[model samples]
Target chain A: MLAELMLSALLLLVTYWFIVTRRLSSAVSAYSVQSWLLGLVALALYVDTRLIGLLLFGLLIVSVKGILIPRLLRNRVAFALVAGRETSYYVRFPTALLIGAGLSLVGLLAATRLAFQPQLLPQSVLGISLAVFLLGLFTTIARRDAILQVTGLLAAENGLLLLSLVVAPGLSLLIEVAIVLDVLIAVLVMGFLVARMRDAVAGTDTSELTRLRG
Target chain B: MIDPALLLVMLATPLLGGISSALVRSDRVRYALVVPTCLVTLALALTLIARILATGPVSAFANWLYLDDLDAVVLLVVVVVSTLAGAYSIAYFRSDAQGHVLRPGELRKYFGLFHLFTFTMVLATVSGNLILLWTGVTATTFAAAPLVDFYGSHEPLEAAWKFLVLAVAGELIALLGFLLLYEAGIASLGSAYNFSIPVMEQAGPHLTASLGAIAFLMVLVGFGAKAGLAPMHTWLPDAHSQAPAPVCAMLSGAELNCAMLAIVRVLSLVTPANKARAGGLHEALLAFGLLSMAVGVVFLISQRNFKRLLAYSSVEQMGLIAAGFGIGAPVAAVGALLQMITHSLAKSLMFFNSGNLLLRFRTTTISEVRGAIRVAPASAILVIAGALAIAGAPPFGLFISEFTIIRGALLNHAWAVGAGIAALLMVAFLALMEPFNRMVFGQGRGEPLPARAELGLGVLAPGYILLAAVLVLGVWIPGPLHSMLVGASQVVDR
Candidate 1:
């Protein structure tokens, strides 16, 4: 339980790093490390439960979320690396971090309040998972860079993955695999759209994507 | 007894069509491949519906894929709209290619993606497993994203990006909801329980109330976003307006229904647990429904773009359907199901008309285009008719369905809800007709009319067919369709 709590704290730290980091590359790397930790948590659960499904799911997470998606995202935004951290945020860093912390607290409180079966997993894991989920959503809204928003979504997705691992690892293997595949496809599609945005709008900032509003 | 093999055939037709269309370089061959594929899929879907109606629900592949009365209703809407959109795309894209708005290569991609989009909707409809259903719904976004950005222009790319981001975020929430639901089921049914719809339904009584409530709300907000219910409906207008006309027709007419179907399926499981829980779910649906109606109406009154006008109208109509189901009376549920069909017909017809307008006037702004009748007489008349029909005027299908829904609300003794529906309908009717009346009839603002552009049979046929269906359904629903609607409603009423 202590080990799981530590991992959860580390995961939360990585997500915070992702939010504060201005460089797109660093944000992506933080996401990668966060995904790896998620995979590690899954593996630890597998060790305790001896569920082969969890074992495969852990590997799948590490390989897909940790490795493949970040690489793809990096390639898509490689040009933005040299462009020197575009300076436009709907919310500034400090306020965003404070909001993130508040969201984490809410997640923690909600997890405790809910009548989650205690024997399924550590309560802290569930709380941290929800926190990461909300932070990811916050990251998407607060950042203007399209790539940052995508990472935010991925972060949220990782949070979901963690929650599912703890709450319903008994979910069918086919479904777990299919969900991963769906996320991969969504990332691929988002990456493609970001590329198109670059070519059409001449940059990847979502602020310029204001043409379609009411 | 329906043959399970038939289901496989129905699904495979589109999968094969999508692959072959992508592989075939020739435009003629691709059109031939896609159009027939849609027709074949539609025929098979109808056959399956008939069989299900006759013999009850059918499950295959160990209940991983199944169709009941509920699935049939959604499947019917999906197949009809997608088939029409498929046929209409030929004319739509041919014009685009000729106008040099799209190159030949892009046309191939459109057909490929179009069929793939259809496949995903079908998959979602027929998925017996909850997880597979979620996967299929999420896949629809990925499939349609490229098509939404087919123009490769600034506005479309923007719309596609927003569509992707918002939809993914919403579906992620829904994913969490499904996880919670699964956990709820495990709490009751043990870890060995299946995630199939029937299993979930059976386990509903055993579900923990708090967990079930949270799960239902998550699914509601998540799928509600996809279904174009406000305030999550921000993506609907942008994506629908920016997409090509046929794609708009499909998005408004079909894809939204598939999303709604997911919500309904989850509601079926969650609400069966107990009365208080059911009532709470109903209240949530009613609130979202009414809010969406108001949002759609307000936006409709101030809209500059005709396509956006139609998109907002969709938001209104979806709201009506949601509210109808929320009424939780048998009559209202039936009305809601009927509204789904009628709305699809009317909305697709209006979009087709908008496509015609876009083709001729080369703009979707309501203020810019005048003297539409002189520009293209057939399309102009159809546009007015479509506007009237969608606005719930008498002698149109929507009016009947909307009336039935109000009657259902009154039967439930929900007078305020009934009055709200009535008032919104009245304002929406006026809001809808005002711009369309101006655009279709008035003399131009000193701009030369395009000389009587000839709309091909391909484009006009779908609109006429849809308009005819909407009109006929207003007056008389065929016996089989009436029965199908009742069967579908009973699934919810249970």
Candidate 2:
């Protein structure tokens, strides 16, 4: 349990780094690392609980989210880097980092009020998971690059998956598998759109996708 | 009674058909597959409803696939809209191909995705499990995102991207709510955690009120966005306008109804447990519903693009339906169900007619295309008729449903809310009618088409059939249909 909480705090730290990073590649790397931490947490729980389902679920997470998604994002990033495009943000890096920290702090406070019993999971671990989720959402809102936005979404899913590991362990494996499939599909589709947007607009900047506003 | 095996067939047939359709290179063979596939789907859906009404809901495969009266209502909408859209796609695509609006290659992709989209909606409607329902709903975004980008134009791509991002985000939040609810069930029922709706229904009264409130509210916002409710409807106008006419028709008319059903199902499941939670859910839904109508109407009055105009009208009608469901009275729920059916038929017809106008005028801007009466008289007449039917005119289905909703609201002593909805409907009606009139009846700025065939009867046939159904339903509903709607309404009433 102590190890789980420590890993969750580490995950939240990586999420904060995601917001503070200037390079799109680093943001994707932070997300990849965060997903790996989640898979590790799942592996830890599986070892403790001796549940084959958790073992399989952890392996699934590591391969699909932790490894494959990041590789896809990295491929896209390599292309963008060769093109010499930077990961631009609506908010500056410093301010965005400050706001992200503030969000984590807020999430820590909000986690105290959650209705879960303490025996299920420590409130602080839950709070860290929630903080990770909020940071992911902030990453999406603050970034202009479509690839980073996809990474942010994956980060958010990672947060939720982490939370479910501790709080809703009774959730059926089938549902978990289905949810993972959706995230994979969402990333694949977003990646395709990012490629298409680059081709059409000659850039990956999403702010220019303003052709259809009222 | 319809066997559960039949339900599985209904679900599997389209998915298989979609895969096979995508492999076909010949447009003729693909379209030949389209009508039969839709007919089989419709036949299965109708049989399912009949069996449900006869035997009082069916569930099989460990309660993974279930059809109640509520599912029956949405299934009807899916069957009708998909069948008509499928039939219309033949003429629509032929004309569009001829006009160079679409290549034969694109048509193959469209038919492929069309069936897949229909399959997703059917899956969403019949699924008894909350997770399965969410899967179906989210899969729709996956299927339709490419369809929204079918034209491959910059505008369509922009719309598709926005639609995908917003939809996936909203749906993910909904997943959180489902997880929360699952945790709540585990806390309460331990070792008996089930995502099945029937299981949840049985456990509803045992659910903690606080958790149920939080979970349902999250579900509301998340599913509400997908349903194109107000304040979260940024993606609706762009995607609806940019997608092809038949795709737009399905998206606006059928998909929205399916999303609404998902929300309503969650509300019904969670609300029966606690009154305070139910009241809160009702108020939230009412607020979202009212806001959607007002925003939709405000946008409708100002839309220059006819397709966007139709899209906003969908928003307004959806708001009305959502508001009726929010009223929570049995009668009002009935009104909401009736409105769902009427809106599906009428809106799809209007979209089909708009497609014909686009084929003739080669434009979507209402101001740019004038004298539709001269350009394509049959489509123009049908457009006008559809506009009136959509605007809640008398002798049309919407008029009856809207009136019934108002009466239900008043009967429930929600006088202020009822009156407000009525006023907004009136404004929306005028907003929709005025633009349609200018386009169809106003002076022609462009020269009429050269001596050529009007829109083929095949293209116009779907619209005519839909309008006729609306007109007949306006005057009177058949006994089985009326009872089905009433039964469906009762399913939602706490």
Candidate achieving the largest DockQ: 1
lDDT of 1 at A145: 87
C-alpha lDDT of residue B257 in model 1: 91
Q: Which ranges of candidate 2 are over 4 A from the true structure?
A: A75-78, A81-87, A118-120, B101-104, B276-278, B445-453
CAPRI classification of candidate 2: medium
Runs of candidate 1 with Cα error greater than 4 angstroms are none
Candidate 1: give the clashing pairs: none
Error of 1 at B151 (Å): 0.8
Residue pairs whose backbone atoms clash in candidate 2: none
Q: What is each candidate's DockQ, to 2 decimals?
A: 0.77, 0.59
Task: Tell how far residue A15 is off in model 1, in angstroms.
Answer: 1.3
What C-alpha lDDT, on a 0 to 100 scale, does residue B425 get in candidate 2?
Answer: 89
- Model 2 chain B: lowest-lDDT 10 consecutive positions: B444-453
lDDT, residue A71, candidate 1: 90
lDDT of 2: 0.84
Cα deviation at B227, candidate 2, in Å, is 0.7
